[model samples]
Target: MRVRVDDASAGQRIDNFLVRVCKGVPKSHVYRILRSGEVRVNSRRVDQTYRLQLDDEVRIPPIRLAEKAAEPVVPFGKPFDIVFEDEALLVLDKPAGLAVHGGSGVSFGVIEQLRRQRPEAKFLELVHRLDRETSGLLIVAKKRSALTVLHDMMREGKVRKRYLTLVAGRWLNPMQHVKLALHKYLTEGGERRVSVNSEGKPAHSIVRLLKRWQSYSLVEVELKTGRTHQIRVHLSHLGFPLCGDDKYGDFSLNKQLEKQGFKRMFLHAAKLAFHHPLTDQLIELEAPLPPELERHVVQVEQTEEKEYG
Candidate 1:
C-alpha cells in the first residue's frame, strides 16, 4: 500500500507511522520491509527510525498481511441490517452469530458478503471489531481515505462505544464502576484468561445498573480502554460474568439460558459515537435491543419482582 505523509502525520517516525496506518502489520515485517528498501520516503531508502517530514511522498510495495487474508467467497449475498451508510463508511447492526471478518472456522463473514454486493469497491476495511458471538453496531469503511480518518479518531480516543448486558447478579445501585488491572495470557490449555494482576495493564469500566431482576441485572457499560474482552474479562473477574458467556461464566447458567431459547452470548454493542470519516460531522448511531434479549430480561425481571416483593 502506497502512502503519502500529510500535515497530520508530520514529524512521525517512518516505521511507527506505517504500522499505525497499515492494519495488522507485524513489527518484524515492518522493519524487514524498511531494511530491504521496500519502503522509500521522498524516493530514498531510509532506516526504520527515519523521521518523516511534512508532505513527504512515500512509495510502499505491496506487502502481505500474514494475520489477514483475502476474504473467501462464501454466501456474499447475505443481507445486513444497515444503520447508516455513505460513500465513506457503512454502519450496520451486526446480529449475533455473524462473524465480522472471516476467522475461527467462519468461512464467510460480513465483509465477504459486503464485497459481493459491491464488486468494484476497493479497500473495504473495518474500523472496529466485534466478537462473533456478540451482536451490535459495526462500522466499515468504504474507501481507504475514510479508513485512515476513522482509525485516527479511534487511536486518539475520540470514538465512544456503549454496550448493554445482563450480568449474573442483582445490582441495585445506579452506578457501579470496576477499576481493575488486567493481565492476559494463554492458559496451558490454550484458552485465553484474564486475572487481576497488579503488574497488568490498567483498565476501567463504568457500569450503571439500569434494572434488576431475581438473578440478573441489566447494565450499561462504557469503556475507557479498548483491551481485548475488557468488559467481559473485567466483569468476570469481579464475579458477575455476563449471562450465557460460556467461556468465562457458570456452565449451569449457560444451560439455563439455552433452555430459555438464548443460544448466543448475552451482549450487544448498543450505541456508537464518532465523527463522520468524510463529512467530519459528529455522528451517533443506536440499535435497540433485539427482541430475544429484551423479552428474556423482561420476563426475568418481572418474576424476580413478584418473588422478592
Candidate 2:
C-alpha cells in the first residue's frame, strides 16, 4: 500500500510514522521490513532514520497485526503536571519513577498515558528523552514542524538544559567543566551501560557546586552535549557519583541513603530554555524540586549543622 506524506506527517522518521500508521504492528517487525528493503520511500529503499518529506510516498508491504491477546492493555490515568503549554508544544514536570515512554518492561509511560488522555489530538511526540528515574521538565511537540525545528536547535547547541543533582563527596570546585568521551555497551545480562573510552562519542557537562553537606554536595549540571547517561557517567568517573543512583553508584551508600528516607535518584531536570520552534519567541521553563527531594535537602543541612557545630 502507498501512503502520501503531508505537511503534518513530514519531518518524522519513517519508522516512527510506520509505527503510528500501522498500529498493532510490533516495532521489531517494522524495523525488520526496513532492513530487508521491504519498505520504500518514493520507490527507493530508505533506512529507518530517513525523515519523510512533503509529497514523499511511502510503500508498505502486507503485514499481520498482533493478535488482540498479544497487545498489552495500557490504562489511562491522570494527566501530568503541566509546566507550560501552547499549540506547538507541551512542557511537563514529569515526576521521578515514571518512564517517558513505555518499553523495557514498562507497559505504559508518560507519552502513552498522555495519548490516551488526549485521544483526539493528532500530533504529539517526545522532543527528547529522560531516564525513567530522572524527573524534571520534559518537552513534547504538538506539531511535526515543531519537533523538527527543536531537534535542529538541540543539534546546533541552541537549546539549554540544566539539571539539579546531589552527589556523594564534597565537590571542591565552584564550577568545573567535564569533557569526556563515552562509549555504550551492554553487560552480560544485556543491560545497557556506558563508560569513558577514547572510542566513545564526545560528551560535555558543566557542574557547579551549589551546596555542601558533611558527605554530599548539591550541584547544578548543564549539558553542552547530550549523550546517553552523560551526566551520571561523568560524575561517576570523577569519583562523585550521584546520590541514590542504582547504576554506576556506590550501592552501599544508596542503601544507607534509602534508610535516611532518600529512596529515589536525586537527579531532576530543573530548567530548560529555548526558542519557540514556530514562533521564534524565547521560552524558558522550570520545575520546582519535588517535596521529597526538598525534604532530603533540609535534612542534609540540619545533619551537617549538628555534626559540625
- Model 1 regions lying over 4 Å from their true place: 1-72
Worst 10 residues of 1 by lDDT: 64-73
Tens-place lDDT per residue, model 1, 84-192, is 9887788999888878888667787888778777778755778888877888999998766687878888877688888999999877779877888889899898877
- The C-alpha TM-scores of every prediction are 0.77, 0.86
Worst 10 residues of 2 by lDDT: 65-74
Clashing pairs in 1: none
How far does residue 159 in candidate 2 sit from its true spot (Å)?
A: 1.0
Instruction: Name the lDDT value of residue 140 in candidate 1.
Output: 94
Best candidate per lDDT, number?
2
Model 1 residue 280 CA deviation (Å) reads 2.5
What's the residue-level lDDT of 94 in candidate 1?
A: 88
RMSD of 2: 3.6
Candidate 1 yields a Cα-based lDDT of: 0.82
Q: Could you tell me the lDDT of residue 107 within candidate 2?
A: 90
Leading candidate by TM-score: 2
Name the runs in model 2 displaced over 4 angstroms. Answer: 1-7, 11-19, 25-68
